[model samples]
Structures are given as C-alpha cells and as structure tokens.
Target chain A: MPIEQDYSKTENGTQPVESDNQDSNKTPTLPSFTANKSSQTVNTLWRTLITPNSPNVTPNSSYYELISFYVYHGLLVLLYFNIFIFGLITFSINRTKLWFFELAYNPSKSPSVISADISKLNKIPKRISVILNLKPEETENGGISGLISDSSEVCAWVVASGIKYLSIYEYGGELKNNIPELRRSVYKKLAVYYGTDNVPTFSIKVPHANAIYYGASDQDIDQQRYKNTSYKPILQIVLLSNVDGRATIVDLTKVMADLTTTNEISPKDITVKFIDDELKQLVGEEPDLLILFQPYLNLQSYPPWHIRLCEIYWEPDNDAVTYPVYLRALQKFSTCKVNVGK
Target chain B: MPDWMSTFPGYQQILENCTSLFASVVRTGPVPQHIGFIMDGNRRYARINQIEVKEGHNAGFESLARLLQVCYKCGVKSATIFAFSIENYKRNSFEVDWLMELAKMRFGQMIEKGDLCEKYGIKIRTLGDKSLLPRDVVECLEEAERTTANNSKAVLNVCFSYTSRHEITTTIVNILENVKKGLIEPGDITEDMITNNLYTGDQPPLDLLIRSSGVRRISDFLLWQCHQEHCDIEIIDTLWPEFGTMQMCLLLLKWSFNRTYGRKKYRGKKETKKEKEKST
Candidate 1:
C-alpha cells in the first residue's frame, strides 16, 4: 500500500482526488544482462531468445508461473524485514521519548515526605542514660540556667531532627519533679508537627542532694552520679568522679596509653578493617554520621566510641548557637567523598 | 604522662574495659570500612588550656594527624575528618583567615613531604561547599586531593565547610537533572541509587558515628543515610580533638561481637534437628 499525501489542491484553491499511477507513457528502466557465445554449452542451450513488448499474459504460460513464484517470495521477505525494522525503531523511539520527559521533570519534588509511622518506631529500643551535669559551679549556671537552655535546645534540636527515642538523665530535685515543664515545652514544639502520641517523652531520675552542690560531694558520690547515668538495661554510663567533673583529652591520652600496652597495637597502626570488623559485629553496619557530646572536651575523658567515628562536637558556648551548625554537619555527609586512591 | 591523664586511677580500668569490649565485639562480626569524624573542639580546647584559640585548632589538627595513623594501625581503610564547617565562617574574620592559612600550610606541607601519602598510601578527599572557601584554599585542597588520588592504601576525607543537608539536596538536584536528560529511569530511583549519586558515593556507610564535645546529637550530619532503623553506632560524650584509636577499637569490637553472636544464634536455630523435622 502507498502512503497518502495531499496533492489535489491547486493554486486556485480547488481540490479533487486524483489517481497516482501516471507512468504508462514513460519507458521502464530494466536491468541489463550480457552473454558470451564462445562456449559450446551456451551455443547448444538455446537457439533463440524470446522478447515481450510488455509483462502481460502471453502464450508462454509456464514462464508466467515461475516469474510469479519469485515475485511472491521476494515481496514476503521485504514485508517481514520492514516489520522487524519498524518494531525496533518504535521501541528505540519510545525509550528516547520517556527519557526526554523524565529529564524535564525533577524527581526530588516527588520525594516521599518522612512518614508519621517513623514516630511509632520511636519506642525506647535502647536504654540511653544521659549524664546531667548538675554542678552549678562547673556548669555556667550551676546546671540551672545553662542546663535548661542547653538541654532545651539540645532536646528540641534532636526532636526536630526526628529522634523520638531517648532516656534523658534527670537530676532528682526540682528538675526531676518538675520535668514536665521541660517536657511540655519540648513536646509543645515537637507535638505541633509530629503529634503528641508520636513524640512521647520518657525520662529517668537520679537522686541528687543540694549539700553535694556546696563542694561537699565525695568521690563516691560523684561516681554514683556517673554510674547511674549510663543508658541502663542494655548500656551503662559512668560519670567522671573528679573535682573539675570534666572528661578531657588527658583522659583520652590515658586510654590511648592503656590500649597501646594492652592490645600491643599503636594508634599509628590502626586500619579501617580493624575498626570495621569490630563495628560490623557490634552494630552490624556503619552509621552514616556520628555526633558526640563535648562536656568539657577533655580528650582523656571522651567517650571511647570516637575512635571509629566522625565526631560532631555539640558544646553550646555562651552564644547559644544551633541550627546552621547542624545543617552544615548534615551537608558534610553528602559533599564529602571517600578519597579513593585512584 | 600529662597531669590530667596521670591523675586518673580509672583510666587504666576504662582502657581495659574498652579493649575487652572491642575484642569481644569483633569476635562476633564484621566492622566499619570507612569511618568519618566531625572533629569539633578546637576553641573549647583552647579556652580550657588558656592559650591562643588558634593554638587549640593547631593542636586539634595535630590530633587529627595522630588519629589518622591510629585509624591506619587499627586496619581502617578510610577516615574522614570535619576540619571546618560552614558555620565556622561566622567566626571573626581574623580567626577564619588564620584557619585558612593553617589549612594551606598543612596541605602544602603534606604534599611537599610526600610522606603522609607515600608512606601510608593515603588519598586525601575534601567535602563541602567549595564556593564559600577562599580560592587559594580550594586550590590547595584540589592539589592535595589530586596528588593523593593514586594512592591505594588508605583514604582521608577532609570535610571543610561541609553540611549533610546540602549534600542531600545537591544529590536530589543531580538525580532530577539526570532523569530529565533521559540518562536514568525515574521509577528505578531508590535509596541505593541516591547513595550512589552522593558526593561520598565511593565511600562506604559509616559504621560507627562518634561526636566529640560530649554533646549527644548528630547535629545534621548524614541525616538521610543514618535514618535507617538498624544502621547506626551512635556514641555521645566524645570530642574530636580528644578521640583516639582505642576508642575506635572498642566500637569495632562491640560491633563485631554483636554480628558474630547474632550469626551464631541464627545458625544454631537453623541447624536444630527438631526445627528441620518440623519444617519437613
């Protein structure tokens, strides 16, 4: 079948349907053939050649049958080939078309919002004991002013970041009994978005006396604070029983020394495998990021886990800064590439 | 020993407990491949020491250098450290200028000596908003990264002015653009696909996340990737300048022990004759 094209309209705007076959007056082009008569085989094969004026039915009916067979088979082969090529072209074009559309629209817009179900998953899966530094003298406000501000900011930040599971360390006095005030403030901000049922706050209390606040706290008393603070049931927290009540680099230096002697491995010889092999067994796999609490930044007293982590320090200075710092740390996870030694 | 370290009688016990915990953990399962650190205590360290704040940062850098060696010694293949964050730019101009100078000098010295990369086969990579940094600092970082790129032994990621949220957004933009270009299928996009498109695509997942300054929070580091329920090792109450390999080992050991124990329990349950009969 021939594809149709509009050719009936004249410059005068008159239109009519016309037949396309108008080649009857023209001579047809034919393939040329040559033959040599020097061979006896050719000479004996035929005495004369038959010629026809046109390909019309004539006396040679047998010749017509052979010609028809070749024509039919040739047309069938051409039709099959055209069909195969067309199918391939269609498939290729469809893929190209889909790609064009996908490129025009951004997929990030289609990102699924974090679901509310995430809150239901926030059961106290892990018992984490936070060491609430109550020494008002040590902490800028004797753990009152700075404590509330810092704790509120920290808790709010964590809650805003979608962390619903935590066992906050509570100082038994006014803070423990009136803890609902802090909880209400945090949850009010949190529950507005996440809903109260999802962001359920949980707390743990430690009995602390004000007499200890007046510089009369013994080492045993301080140690008790430390021991009581670790995430319990599964994890434990031990506070530093010291006058300064700070975990410092000096503490870390000591730990490093002990590790060198006990494991007979120097810090200089550590490897990713050594850390990974151990961590994979414990946590199963690695986390994408790590945040550490810097109470005083005493390297000696820092948590032992900083060894295999990218530590983020969360020490609030007098400036009371937050947000942008957290955002910046979050950005690092994406921009930072593992220096693949090419 | 330093006065602070020497004075602590519990230091030895903590070290012993840490080692045993780590050893036991490792005996159980696999550990992290590449560990990244957000070193966050130069100013506080300085304030405590009553020294110039710059000196505290310089000391922090030294601590990072030592920590790298420790990571290598402990068999960690890659370690990324957050030397500077975008928020640090809010500091006084002079301090920021000094930090840039220190970074340039440190990178220059490392490249010149060829010792850091040559001996340890360390490849240095940087992550952050490069546009915000001084041109010279960016140039030095690029050079450092390029020079160490061929080293195969270990990788060192230096995140300067980095933020995890920006990274995620950037990846989203990239994915969207790629999809538009017909280079990828939109429906085929998944979490792993996003991970592959991230700046740290080549790096492995963070095995253990440790933050310094003894404050408990991720502070917006790796929000998307770390959101998975079971994929984290979070430890609060550590500072960047103060952390060491012993800490790394302890975390690793704990991770390993958990895996090994879980696997053992699983195998024991699977191989029980009664269980097999019940299944039949």
Candidate 2:
C-alpha cells in the first residue's frame, strides 16, 4: 500500500482552534516578559562578545529601540543572504539541465569533461559472476523462469574470449540477510561444476555478506515433490571434447515422467533410471570431460538441497536468484573458463 | 547522368542541372576511420534459399570480401567484422566444424594471394580469444596477421571469439595485477591505460557499427568503448553475402552526412517565438 497524501499544513494555513470543545472557553494568551528573560541572555552574550573597544553611544536612549534596530539590520542581512543562495541554486539547476541535454544529444562525447573526478575504471573492476543453482532443491524462486534472458549471445562472447576468474555471488543474497552455509554450498556447487581442483583458480568469493528471502514453501507444488527435489534438475547438457568446447543440456521434465512406471511408491522407480540414461547421454562416457545441469528453469521451485544433503536442515531463500541472471551467469562462466573436469 | 539516376524523381532533374553539388557534399563529409560489422542471419538467409547453414556462412564470407572493397573505397582506414563468436562453437558439431574450415580456407587464400597486402596494402589482424579456436584455424589466422603486419593501407580486424565484457575485464584485471606487483602506480592508470591494454590497442574508437542480417543488438561485440561516439545501425532484409558496395556506400554516406552536419546550438529562438505567440 502506498502512503496517504498529507499536505494540509503546507497548502492551507488555517488553524483548527474553534472546532474543538476544549478550546471554546480558553482565550489565546500573549507571550509574557518571563519568556523574554531567557532571550536577553542571548543578547547579553552577543554584546559581551562584540562590545570590546566599542564606540560609546547615548546611554539614555531606549534599550528596546536599540535592540529593535539591531534585529531589523540582522533580518535585512539574512534576507540578502537567502536571495544570494536562491540565485546560486537556480543557476546550478539550469547548468545541470544544459549539461544533461548535451550528454543526450552527443553521447559519444567523452564523459570525463562533465563527469565528476573519479578514479580510472581500470582501478575498480566490478565483476558480476553468475552460477546456476540447477539442483531441484535449490529452486525457491519460480523454477527456471527467472533465470534465462536474451543475453546468452553475450555469454557466448565471454566464453570465446577466455575470461576466467569471475565473482560467484548467490543471486538475491541480501533478501535473507547473511546465510554462510548457503554461500558455502553455492561455492561447493561451483567447485563440483568446474571440478574441485580448478575452483581455487577460477572463482573468487562473493564478499557481500547478505541474505535473500524465500517466499514459497516446499509443499507449495506437490506433496510428493520433496521426494525428487534432491538432485540437480538439468535443462540442456553439452559436451565439448574437440574444437571449441560447446555443450548442450538434456531436458528433465519428460525424462522424469518417462521414469515413473508404476503410479505407486517403490524403491526401483523408473524416474531414477531415466535420470541415469539422460545424464549419460548428455555427459557422454568421458570420466572428467563433460557435465550436465539445466540453465533456465520455470514452474517448479528448486528444493533446499544443502539442508537435506548435510542433514543440518537450513531453510533456502526463495528469492535468491532470478532466471535471467542465472542463465547469463552460466553463459559467462562457460565463456571464461575451460571446464577441465577431473 | 547514369541510367539508374533516370529512375528517380528529384534526382533526375538534379543530375542534369547540378552534378558538382553531389561531389562537393561527398568531399566535405567527415569520412569514417573504422567501420565494424556484426554479421547476423546466415541461418535465416540459408532457410530462405533452402540452403544449409554452412552454405549461408559461405555466402557470408563472400559478402565480407565485397564489403571490404567498399570500405576501402570509402576511405575507411580500418574495418572489423564479427565472423564467429565463441558460443557459436556450441551449435551442432557439423555446422561448427564447417565454419572453422571455412575461416581457415578463406583466410588462407587471402593470405596466399597476397591480396590484402600487395593489392590493397591492408594489414590483417585477428581479434578475440584465439586460444578457443581449433589449432589449424589459429595457425591460419596467425600467418595472415604476420604476413600483413607491415602493410599501411588498412587494418582488417576479424573478431572470431570475442566478447567486449571479457576484453574490458581482462584489461582491468591486468591493470590491477600490475599495480599490485608494484610495476605501475595506481595514479598512472588513465582511460588510455585501459584502452592501450585492450586487444585493439593501436586502433581508434569505432565511428560506425553496422550489423548485417537486420539485427538491432550488437551482442556484446565491443562493450566499454562504444556507447557514446559510435552509431549502431541495422540494414533490413539484407544478408551479409547479398550486401554489396552499393549498400556500404549508402550507409557510409548517411553516417558521414550526420557527423558533418550535426548541431550543437540551443533552440532558444523557437522558444522565444512560441512565447511571443502565447502572450498575444
């Protein structure tokens, strides 16, 4: 809800005195001489501070008139001071408007001339590294819908350029406050994806200590959804052994449906068998050369896997990552590092 | 007047009366220094022609050569075209393999013919992540760049596995590491410091960026350097192969005219006229 509008005091100057019954018999009282006694203290201090070697004036003159003259002169000075400040403010606003117009018309002009004096863009390399928490248990946000965007093409460029060393931040880290365990889990997943050995060289810790909030509960989807939410829910899997390393992810929804044969709960579920086959097809027979994980997800929420995996039980932030950024991060990661699996 | 001029409306009369006026406009325009092209839509073009994706790429390669000639004639000192991106390698294996072969074969021929250096005095330079490319393709690119290094006519930058974000970040990382190593002072790092560290260190800012195949987005081609000064343009219904000298001429003419005839003065007179009318 937006806040209610309130501008009665500013827009209109009417005092509400007669409306209330308590104030009907009360007469407005003028400020008394007692109030002026404390104000005279300020006057005495000013005179003491400025009256050193002061020119002698007629002592018989009215002190009230003298103080009134001084007050009027002070007020006059303040009026002129305010006028000067207003003029400066108007000039500044006009100058800024002119500059903004210039920037829009000639965007190619070097921004340094008009921009504030700041350090070189080189000094601070603000890097954004994206990691897709593909594990189904990780979906607190609405499936993969928030993870993919049109920037996949840019991600391709990043990979081709051989840019490694990215800042891996958990998406929506600020919403939940600071979850150290989640951060650790995020890095662990990266280590697994890039291989544990390459983790030290390829990724940097997300220095921001923050929490992302979760809005959905695990039971929001299907009551039995918890059973299949432990492992990574893959989208497309790619394997790159020759030429330029390019891989695609395998589809999961159909595979899972194909795995379920008996509509009853059983140890030998067809879904696990399907997952194995799909993983094999995507990663190939190579031991350390390929891997699979869904890039963009939607519909189903990713379950909290770290809590289940370690059995410590920690709640996952539902709003931790958006789909578009997740997709972009995967693209950027693939572009930067040559995932040499071990 | 040429036969094509007769087909036009006002141009027909202008051709008869004022011939030098057209030449004068051309001479006075500020010719672009470097013109870059983001070649798109080979697959679409291939589909339209009932051809394979490889065939579309081959057609694109041919279009590139013709475009280069037009760029040279326009007095453009440098021209860079995005031939292949790193992510493009992730497509179907057969298609990706064909593209690698195509780059090697086409670039190798251009190098062997000495056409780039001997005929046009142009120097060939390859940009982007060369390491990600096949060994054979890398070798072909290196030979081409080395052979044409001494040429002074023009610089042809073939952006193969390039991403502007990676390039900028790489430069920044290098600068950061250099500072940490005590090899350079932090204060010494300027805008030029970052620019000089980039792959195209010796080149100037792009004047015009033309994406063929009618795509509006640049797709992270040249990120940090290109926001303000460059024009990102798209041509409608034209594949890279079909884009000829005429297309390049039209684009360059429009760009040069804009640059030369750009305005800087404020529109105070119009405001004053409006105010006078409002008062009445």
Candidate 3:
C-alpha cells in the first residue's frame, strides 16, 4: 500500500489533491463558500487528471478484469511516438469541438432562463440519469461542495422541467456519504428556483446504502397535509457510484452461485428475467435517458444492465455540470426515437 | 460493372496500400487488442437510399469485411460484431428470416472462399444459444467454425442471437452445471470465473466498442465487457452501410491517440512537484 501511494505520487500530479479532497468529504460539515465564476466555468481541462477512475484492481473480482485492465493500460505507455502528429491533430480537433459548444450554449444563462428554454422543448425524459465528475478542490466549485451543488443544480432544473426521476452518478460515491449536505444543498437550490413557500417535496434515495432522505422536515407544519398520500414524491433522486455498477453484479453472481450449491436455487433459475428483477431491486430501473457530463462518451462504469435501450447524451470536450448541457441533453432526448429492437 | 474506385485498375491497389501504410503508422502506437461493433443504422441507410433492406444489409456486410481487413492490418487481435441480437428477433418475420438467410449466406461464403481465413488465420466463432438457431443455419455456422478452428492467429466473434444478459445468465447456468457435477465449487465463482465462462471469454477483454449512426446506447451488446474503464465506446454518426474503411481507420487511430497522449495526461498530473521535492 505504501509503495502504491509512492508510485501514484510519482505517476500522477493529481494524487495530492485527490487524497486531500477525500479527507474533506469524509467529514459532514459545510464550509463557507465564495464563488469564482471565472475558474468554475466548465472547460475541457483537468478531467484527465482524476485518478482511480478505473475500477480497483483489487483481489475482489480478481484475475480476468484485473489482469486485462492493467495489461491494456500498460500497453499505452509504450510510446512509439510514430502517431505524434496524428495525435496532435486529433487532440486539437476535440478541443475545437468544445469551443464550438461553448459558443452555442452560453454558460452565463441563468437557471430560470434555461428552465424556460427547457420548457419550450416539445418533450422531456421522464427519468433522467447523469454522470458527474468531481474536480480538484483548488478550483472554485470543485470537490465535495461542488459535487453537492452540481447535484442540487440538476435537481432544481429537473424539478422545474417536470421530470419525475433523476439519478446522479459520481464515480467515487462521495455524494452518497454526504447525503445530508446534499439534501440541504438540494433543498436550498430548490427554494431558489421554486421559492421557499411553494417548495415541492422530494426524496433522495441511496440504494446502495439502503437509505432514503426527504427534503421536507417532519416537524415542519407546512408539510402536514401530505401525510396520507405519501406514496410518490414529486422528484425521485437516486445517487449511484462505481460500486453500484459492476461490483454489485459481481456480488449478486456470488450469491446466486452460493444458492445453487445449497440446492435452494437451480442452475436454470438464473434466467434473464430473474437477474433483471434482482438488479432492478439492487439498482433502480433503467432511465429513459442517460446524460454524461464528461468531455467525451465514456460510461465510467455505469450500471451496465440499466444502460440497455437508454439513450445517452454527452457533449464533446465538455466536462462540467451546467444548465446548457442539461438543457441540450433534454432537447436531444426529445428528438430521439427509441424503438426497442425494431 | 465496377465500383467507381475499381474503375481505375491501379486505383484500388494504391488506395489499399496507402491505407495499410497509414494503419501501420497508427499501429506503432497503442492498439486495442479487441474491438466491438454494434453496426447500427442499416435499416435507416436502406430507407434513406431507397434501396431494399436486404441490399442495405449487403452493403453493410461489405463495409464490415473491408473494416475487418483494415483492423487486421492495424494489428488488432480480435473483433466482435453484434450481427444479430436476441431482441432483434422481435422484428417482423420477413426481415428476421432474411437476416438469418443473410447470416447463412455470409458464413457459407466465408467458408467457401477460404481465402480471408487462410490469409488472416482468422478463427470464426458464433456466440449465443445455438439451440435458438434453425438447424440449417446452425450447420453452416458450425462448418465455418470447424474449418477455421485450427487458425491460431485472430478471432472474429459473430454475436448472433446474443444479448449480454443471456450470455451472463447462460454462463452462470454452465458454472452451476459444473458445480452440480462437483467439478467446481460455488465459492469459487469470482468475477473472473463469470468472465471466462462467457462465450467470448477466451478473447481479449473488449478495448473499444463502436456504434454507428450516432445513437449513444449500448443496446445490450457486450454490456458486461464494456462497463469497465479499459473499454471505450465510440458512437459515430455514419450509418453502417455508409461507414467506410477510412472512417473506421480514423476511429481506430482516435482510440490509439487517446490511449497514448490524450488519457495519459492524467498519469503524470503532479509528477513535476513530486520530483522537485525528491531532488531537493
């Protein structure tokens, strides 16, 4: 482990910031904030610096994935330098695309104005899933607070746009640990958009952690009329990370394998529907649209089963959680036609 | 009588040679050992071009052959094409039947030609439940596999009548069958066990997955293999029929570029500061 840390330190410059951010997120308090809009502007830089973005090559899911993950990545460092010009040209092309999108979608547009733009769209996704990445703390609106605010910002937009369910996936699962702060942040953001008196109720679900949090406090007399019809919240939010994706499936397979040995379940019992229902219970239903707020189209190990038939939207060379990308994704979703296997 | 490029006798050979030179240059960088293709948008291409659906499929098959040759030239070890899906069975009966006929015809052609197989030393494998296929189609696929079985170089995974869920499910069933026979224990079922048990398990773990016509969805193809960080899913705007060898080569080149300088930018993020402190 010590050697691994030393190796990481020498290998990646972002190791220091990554470890520092981890310590801050483990605590459950909100620090004072001062916004710096200039640096926080969503840019293509700094995305590649994130570490442990790959699955842990631990002994858990041991040999095959572990061996290949390293083997394939290890080959990248061979550095033939033959395709250097080709690489440079392709690299510049990607950044140019990001610049084009920046011009198209102005980041300075306020949330309500973007909401109106979203409202003008002919259709919207009922269930929307987003993949969020955490930036280093040195930048404004980066790290833990940035993740919470980003989640809250999306929640507020979805609520305004009348979307029912939203799943926010951060690779590290840091938001899962800070549910209360996330709830507080989300509620505050909702109040900003919907006004405090008319704030709609919502719930935050962390399926992996087996916890559900409500936006409205129980002691609040303003929420007393909603007791009998508690079946549905206006907004249903689920937080997910890499753990809930493949690792969950690996654990389920182990369970099924164990059950087969005990004669509790037969080999034939592991059917498509059986695994589907089981995974649906473990991770929520497949979203109608999966939006990745990354520079490129990488799943970053999203729950694989749920991605089937789900339309994915991501801007090229863009990696910030902003209203323009979200609004554009909704527009894209509205234009898409999902004819299952037709 | 001839395609426009082929109208010029020397044009075809020169183009291929130049492409091979370009491919060799790109191949000098990191190359993904295994590549997967969803091959979407054939029907759309047919609709747009006002061609018969079968013709669009034929065009797609030609494109795939050319692309596969290019991939071999670029030094990829194996390639998986989602030729047919279990859910694709839901399409109209006529189309399904024609698709099956297409598979049979294509597999038979590959075997009969014997040139591509001999040239590339390609081993052909059909992944999915063979029980679902018609007996005649099964026999053709089997014959193709058998003839190419001894080829020790590369593999072409034809995912016919396959879905990732079905593959994982059946793999579990096979594992349990072993367990029932006392050859394996339930406790031994790690992820690698599940991985190795799948039909394409012996092939390299998918490095790059490509889908055409700009639909950014996995569509239940290689869901297990592609979820990890090692795999990159590229959704191109070109329809399958219109997808060309040059464009496909560009995609492969993009993958190599990203793996080399693009993504590796993160690997040395703080190395300068760390090295300075160590030197002091």
The iRMS of the candidates, in order, is 27.5, 26.8, 7.7
Q: Could you give candidate 3's fraction of true interface contacts?
A: 0.53
lDDT of 1 at B44: 75
Q: Name the candidate, 1 or 2, with the larger TM-score value.
A: 1
Off by over 4 Å in 2: A1-342, B1-28, B114-117, B230-237, B263-280
Per-residue C-alpha lDDT of model 1 across residues B161-260, encoded as one tens digit per residue = 7766556556655555554455755455665666677677887765555567654444445544443323443454455556665665545554444343
How good is the docking of model 3, by CAPRI class?
acceptable
Against the true structure, what is model 3's DockQ? Answer: 0.27
Task: Between candidates 1 and 3, name the one with more favorable DockQ.
Answer: 3
Q: Cα lDDT of all candidates, in order?
A: 0.48, 0.46, 0.78
lDDT per residue for candidate 2 within B140-243, as digits (tens), equals 99998898888888888888877664465455555555544557664455656666788777887777777665433346565444433244333344777677
Which stretches in model 1 have alpha-carbon errors above 4 Å? Answer: A1-342, B1-29, B236-238, B262-280
After superposing candidate 3 on the true structure, give the runs of residues whose Cα lies further than 4 Å from its correct spot: A1-115, A216-229, B1-6, B264-280
Ranking of candidates on TM-score, top first: 3, 1, 2
Local distance difference test, candidate 3: 0.78
